[model samples]
Each structure stands twice: as C-alpha cells, then as structure tokens.
Target: MSFCNPIPIRLKEARKKAKLSQKALGVRIGVDESSASPRMNQYEKGKHTPDIGTLKALADELSVPLSYFFCEDDISAELAVNLNKLSLSDKQKVLEITARLIDESKKG
Candidate 1:
C-alpha cells in the first residue's frame, strides 16, 4: 500500500486513543467548532487528506508524533507512541537495543 494509506487508519486509532470525538479533535486542532465534526469525519474516511500543517496541529493536539500517522503497521505505530514517552537518553538506548536485536536476528 502507499505510505499515505496508513494515515487515515492511524489517525482514527490515535483519535480514539486520545478519547476524542471527531469534532473535539478538529476543534482542538483549530477547525471551526461548527464544521469540526464534518471536517474530521472526512479525514477519517479518507475522503480528504489534511495538509502537513494541519496534520502537525492534529498531532500536537492528540499528543502523538506526526510520524505515527505514517507508520505502515500497527506495531510500528504503537512503537512510535511508546517511544514518544521516553526521554532523549532513553530513546537513544531503545534505538541501540533495537539495532542490536536486529543484528542478532540477522546473524542467527
């Protein structure tokens, strides 16, 4: 699937995880309150894609990294969410461990 294919699925997932209704998320991301639900619904339905700037605002409001919306699978998307909770040093440690695991798997 195209990279953009994951976006609507991940957007819906993140919005749900944040416990937000479509309207609420849209409003929080600066859409007019009156039009928020319809706008967000269109996005979730993949009928319209938000621009990068709007996506960034949605990411900020939902407390997820913008990259989360582009992850190709659920595991990677979930990893991004968990990774966002780490400190800079801790994140570096995770990257090191992940790389080591990949090397070990490759060698075995």
Candidate 2:
C-alpha cells in the first residue's frame, strides 16, 4: 500500500522547532521576501514539493539532516534530531545500545 507523504509534516515541525515563521524560513532559503510566506505555506500544506537541492537547503537552514525529511514516523523523526547532535563516537554507542535493545526485544 502507498503511504501518505511525511515531508510536509516534517518541514512544519522543523520550522516550528527552530522558532521561525514561514516567511522567515523562506527568506533564509533565498525565496523572494514578498512571496516567502505563501511559498513556505504551500510547502507545509503539501501543495508544493521542493526539488532535492531546495530540500537540502531547507534541511540545512532548519539544522536537521536531509534524512530527517524522509523519516516515516514521529518517534524516528524525533530520534533523528537528537542523534544529529551527538558526536560520531557517541552516535556509534547509541547504535550499539539500540541494536542490543532490538535483539533483547526479539528474544522476549
């Protein structure tokens, strides 16, 4: 079955988390200031999808990884944000811990 698109929701969440207005985010990503709000609103509403390059710019401006936009679930999305803040070594540690947790869950 096909799944609903999650990019719109993720974009809105990241924008709000960054404490930015749609107009402000649009301007930061190089949209015309006058049309910024409407353009950003369209993206958030799923009326328009940005190209890959534009999506990358948005992800950078929002301080999230490009993969964050593709996350399929809220929990994974939130985890992505937190994971992005960790050092490489710390990230590896988290991966190890999560792997063990998964294995334990499978055994239970």
In candidate 2, which residue ranges exceed 4 Å CA deviation? none
lDDT tens digits, residue span 1-108, model 1: 544578899899989988999999998888999999999999999999899999999889989899998999889988998999999999999999999999999999
On lDDT, the leading prediction is 2
Give lDDT tens digits, candidate 2, residues 17-100.
999999999999999999999999999999999999999999999999888999999999989889999999999999999999
Each model's Cα RMSD = 1.6, 1.3
CA lDDT of every candidate: 0.92, 0.96
Q: Against the hidden reference, what TM-scores do the models get?
A: 0.92, 0.91
lDDT of 1 at 63: 90
Alpha carbon deviation, residue 64, candidate 1 (Å):
0.8
Give the winner by TM-score.
1
